[model samples]
Target chain A: MKNILFFTGRELTVEEMQEPIPDLHHFAVQPGVSDEPKCQRCGNETNFSSHPCARCGKECLYCRNCIKMGKISSCTTLYRWTGPEPDVPKAAGILHWSGTLSPGQKTASDNVLQAIQQQKEHTVWAVAGAGKTEVLFAGIATALSEGRRVCIAAPRSDVVRELAPRLQNVFPNTPPAALYGGSPDRHTYSPLVISTTHQLFRYTAAFDVMIVDEVDAFPYTFDHSLQYAVQKARKTESALIYLTATPEPSWREDIQSGKRDATLIPARYHRQPLPVPSMKWCGNWKKSIVPPAVLEWVKTKEKALLFYPHIETMEKALATLKAIDSRIESVHAADPLRKEKVAAMRRGEVPVLLTTTILERGVTFPGVDVAVVGAEDRVFTESALVQIAGRAGRSADCPTGEILFFHYGKTTAMVQSIEQINEMNKLGRQKGLLDT
Target chain B: MNRCLLCENGTEVDSWRAFFGAKAPPLCEVCTASFNRLSGPCCHVCSRSLEEDGECTDCQSWRKSIFHSNVSLFHYNEAMQDVIAQFKYRGDYVLASIFAEKIRTEAKKAACDLICPVPLAPSRLAERRFNQSEALIVCAGLTAAPLLGRHESEKQSKKSRAERMNAVQTFYPTGEATGKSVLVIDDIYTTGATMRLVADALADAGAASVKSITIARSGS
Candidate 1:
């Protein structure tokens, strides 16, 4: 039944269910947070609190980490379905994308398919604009054909929203259920699921193949609970595909030491090298007025995205930039007009968009130059700088664009981002993936 | 690092001051600003924000009521609604601390002999895992006197204002209330129906006076 399918892989509290089912699996909501306490839903070991419970009339320990998903206390009962797995119709001729994959994408796609078939963990260390999503199409199609559930989880809702339609276009026969906070398709059951990583807290062993896009993106790379959610959302023996433009330093070492399996695509599908950021010393842009170097860069009249460390600084600078051009807009994560501003930039209505690091990735603005006003700020991590540079030179017609890093003093992230870009370019040329 | 209980942002406080004081403030400045404190020209009886200083319509209608007055701290705006939902409905007990200081101040001003939390029905208690009123009292460093027991009734949140007014009294005295000034503590004073019912029951039990203090007061 549709109702049973909804509960197939979900862990819901008794109260959330409204009424107790006749026969199903039930477990202690909180698994004793006293001795090495951990949240069963999110696997958060810390951030636990206790209060006197009226249900059991005892002190109940609850997890504060995943409380946003609804509180899970020691006194509550969590229900799951231990019955037979729901019947998922095998989807054939699922992938309908007509676009062809480049040689680099083809190799990575083959590796992804192999990983899915063998149920092994693999990483796709592809550069930004390298068509990483296309690499997953074959594997997802193969998995769905076998009647196995697949999940493509991203760290941010923005990425999930951007990915859902593209995946739906390719897999026409199997429309993936997209899940996020306040999403309309909450209870839809489908073979393929596209969801934000936060939504995975309610799922348990739901996917046969789990693909985590933007694995190095914020709150995913920083928050350990998101990683735990990915692990928990997958079956006991399932394949994992970690897609990221820049992996963490430790993961790079693991790839080199042969401890992890990986496939690297160093070039974009356009066969052009990534734009390397050039650092220019601009003294004290925060305290003083917008530096002359930044002014000169803006005067070039190329549609650009100027990244700032914080929203306050970006908004303060917006007035000066708007004096130069009224069409210039500023946006941040909390800005209600974020989507509209980004769209305005995409439509080339805005000359330059000043923003915080929220716009560093998962957005494509073709033929736009990129610059970081405060490249020395700690918020601009190495991967962030690289992703910011990747925003340029995306469209094949205009295969090259400038990336400027204007700063008081270049930080290690700036130097490393440039080095990584050059290294990827070098590798791309050597592998014949780039037009030298 | 001390994080805010509401927003989870790092709460910056002087270390020495916190070390010397009872405890650091539980919320950051931004989150604290979201709570709209009741101030200037509120109703004398129910503390509802009014254009001029006088009793509100609801309090005016309760001219024959037994309770003297109700003092509430914050206006039941959207932020207070979310706070109450998290604390009472979602069972996030730690959120009760957000209102601790304000509740403590209000309760002290009331100066009642007995601090009584409006009891929840046994079924509601079993579902929510804690009596939110009791949690508010205890978290505010005030001892709660379980002076009332609630009979099984439909949830007040599910009922309309007219229905709540016409509904039968649900609370009965569980402890001695003779000649005692009772200050009833509840999370939100919505319709004044539940509070008046509790006050009537306490009055029937021969309490000297009944005054109430709530964290938030909804404009009925």
Candidate 2:
């Protein structure tokens, strides 16, 4: 019998067995929602799945933690071919990208290549729009040349969607397979794979080179199960690279404590300073949006993202903000037309979008001014505020824009968000990497 | 560690403890407010809560029915749906304990010769490992005796309200009843079809009387 692997590594009963032929081996899937039924996204395994799931109709002991990437339940099953190694994903490929990395990107890119070659774990602490993906092209190319399988994963599907085409463009000879929840190429195997970290649940010691983008993003920042997924999905000798524009303070502590190796790229690819957020008291925004201040800011930009603390409140704010511009629209995770709404914004048809924290990261619009309605809400944490600010000045053409926080009261998150950007910019200047 | 079965929001102490006495449900405050209990005037036959002080149309058929009366603890709402879904479908048997306590408090009304759980098919028994209603009876510190049996049939969950209300009789007594009074217990009273069938089977076995108890009843 061909070797097969079960999702959650469960002990297959006789009834579930299609045929018990020679060499048939069953795996005991771990018993955990976070630990066993690993979230295919941020990999957090909190004990919150105590609610009965509607899907499996079983008390599904797996991770019931609500996530954008789909919930993992005990009934959710993933099968893998463990009969024999499917003859490694070897393919013919040559570097075909025409774009060259900047001097800073070149240094980080070289460091990544050297670390991956030695099978050592490393972190690429690049700022937003620091050409972080480009820094991986060289390292990936070198790995492919040596016939090692490579996988690039991120907590958000958008990052995987964004990275796949770029990686495929750079390595035209070796097309990268993109895997997400509903991805059509889920079963297909390729030498180069780009997938959301959640899809890593089906793999076990599979890749030789693993690159995780947006390591500090939602579902990924605090979730240890995703880290567990990363570890289980790669070979023991594989090189794992954590890429994040905003590294958590704990990571800084690790680097300072000499517990981890890191390459910190403080400046953007264009060498411009990160745009710092300026807080403006709008006085209890739970009551209203100060139209004059917001109108003045929106009047300068072609597009803007106005953030909210909750869905119910965002709907109310969306109604009020519609007076500012008829072209304004709203989107959230539950909105069926969310894709179309975001596409309209990208085409510059919509001038303003009222959204919740769902769009805090893994989304970028060039030179788009951004603002937070209630910066004091606990939902807007320091890291989240930092990612929201990172959305500004993303495009090379528009390297600077306004990042404002209209708050009922100035919050520590607001202050720390500004401090984090300023600190990075200061480090950039100290290293002589910034234009100003 | 006492995660409220309803809204997963509050700590077990300050949140759940804030509502003490008879109002202290095994749920958080927000969820406690959503709990629809079967209080006030109800149909004497089916125990369904009513706006008036008489029997409901479904229970008005009690004159032609085999079951003498039925009692339920809660009106099936969204909270009950999740609770029952966890118990019946997800097979989170532990959830049965919550209902067990409530049923035990109410079981004083069901003094009978023996308490019988609505039987489950052997296939479902193998898959789920335990019948949900049986777990409720066992956990209530009551001795659950097997008084009925049924062949493997279509599960009631897959049926619509109309289908369940008119479901053909499937249950039969496992042994002779011989004028003995019995109480039938189930997880949820959806359209009263399962209870009707079980009660009818007990009546056919020459039982003197049949009564039914359920944790929650379909309010819709």
Candidate 3:
């Protein structure tokens, strides 16, 4: 068993906390990374960082930031990484290649490879355009070489469509089965099966290597039953790999504590830094056909996506935009021709496509700008906003673009999402892993 | 001396309950043979063993079941019926486990590829906070396949045999079973209505064959 540290007020080594289940955790910090920034109390700057606090000898240190926000009273906690890093076998045959893997991708792939070799569970979190699909090929190839059945499960049907061809090319000799609500070749069986997570429920201790992509996305992430189903489908000896861009705080804690093995990919695949979405307050935005500045921006943006929270507002927004310039079309879940309309936008037949969160994932274009009219809407959580912003600059043709979240009042999720994107970018830049 | 349940002539060996409680007096050999004959002739289709005929008259003919066979352990006597009701309503999970263990031994003969419990409608699951069939599966130490019963229909308790058969076709298995042999499990088998219908559902979902096992079989 791997050793991991857990903190509760006092710094205790992983060996100390032998309790079966712990209570509400304060913080899960990496072990031995005690580069304390500054002390809020006494305004004292401490450079001498050690396992134990210098003054109080307490391992938990409350930073100046939290103190300034009057949140320092809460106990500070640290979590140490515990999982083993195993080496994975190499990929066989001409592996399908459609994307690039930055240093972060290498880290993720390496972690996954190790997990597979050791028969341990691991998580790989890469920002959108981090080439999540490409990074997985090596690890999957490793598992396949060991005569293990690999399953790549996603939450969305569209994602399955996008990965089908790429996976088919990667495992060229061994035909992979694509399973979803509607797939003509679903009947054909293969060792490597790509299916929606819901489809996993039908299986019993089937896959030896189950890779759940977009683990933090809809359906799979939100539905408890679906999560249970994935676990049930996994054989007792199998390693479950969770891949996602935006992981919830608890999962991050689990990783920090070494309770779970996690590899973070903070950079995009193309080596270009992710575009940061600037916040704009369009005051009484509904009254105007288009704000002068926004209108000018739209005219210049050859390909752009407009997001509306509600269907009724989307209809009005589409009508208003069309009255000013007749090149706008709106699509929602209820739209009969949603697939066709999305296809049209992808082909550049329509310049601006207004949509809901339904288009938050799956569909991708080379270069398209995105704007959310109501950033603070109920549907747009921190996770949703990050995914929406991720859609802005994803393609090889147009890897760098802009994302705008226009709102009357901003929520914590909106602010947090921007911070997370910037934080990932900063981490990438610091490591010199940002796409050139 | 306690009498045997199957044959009143033999002395009762201490039951598992009495043995576990350290109250066992020694089993009578005659009682063992009598209890072994506890089983009776059941309906070929529903497992409701008949008295005169080998198979019950109701299910003598070939029926439409992807599940070609069915089996049950105990006859639905007052004690068994009471135990089932208590297992579900009184949260006596141990009883369900006991029932499942009995069913598992009986089902092992079939060698089914997968175990599918008769799905509880979402509405019933919400009300009870658990699936009765799921409890038995766990008790049986069987792998419970992920199959959902959608669109709530009339309860089986109120429906007649024909109505239950008609309603079974509507219970669709969400995913394809890929022609695997499936064994459906439930706590009790009444008119064999639920089993026949569940078999049909499995067949519709591309199951190659279906078989059923229940904790207890209802006597006519």
Per-residue lDDT of model 3, residues A211-329, tens digit only: 99889887666566567667766779988899888888888788779888788888887777888888998765656635565666677777888887778777877776787568678
Best of the candidates, TM-score = 1
Give me the displacement of residue A348 in model 2, in angstroms: 4.5
- Residue A223, model 3: lDDT of 64
Candidate 3 residue lDDT tens string, B1-220: 6432222244543477766775322224543322222365545666665665466656755365575766777666766665666555533344454445467777788888888877767766544435677767865777788654756877777777666645545477776788699888787777676777777777777888988877776746
Task: DockQ for every model, please.
Answer: 0.66, 0.11, 0.01
Q: What TM-score fits each model?
A: 0.90, 0.77, 0.53
lDDT of 2: 0.75
Docking class of 3: incorrect
Which residue pairs overlap in candidate 1's backbone?
none
Best by lDDT: 1
Candidate 1, A1-436: lDDT as tens digits = 6667677677776655634354544332334233467777788887877898877778889988888788877665566667777766766437798899999999999999999999999999999899999999899889988878899999888788888888888888877789999888787777788999999988888889999998888889879999999998899999999998999999999987989899999999999888888999999999854798888888786589999998888888898888988999999998999999999999999999998989888888889898899899998889889999989998898878999999998788989999999999999999999876
lDDT for model 3 comes to 0.68
Q: Native-contact fraction for each model?
A: 0.69, 0.00, 0.00
The CAPRI category of model 2 is incorrect
Error of 3 at B143 (Å): 41
Best model per DockQ: 1
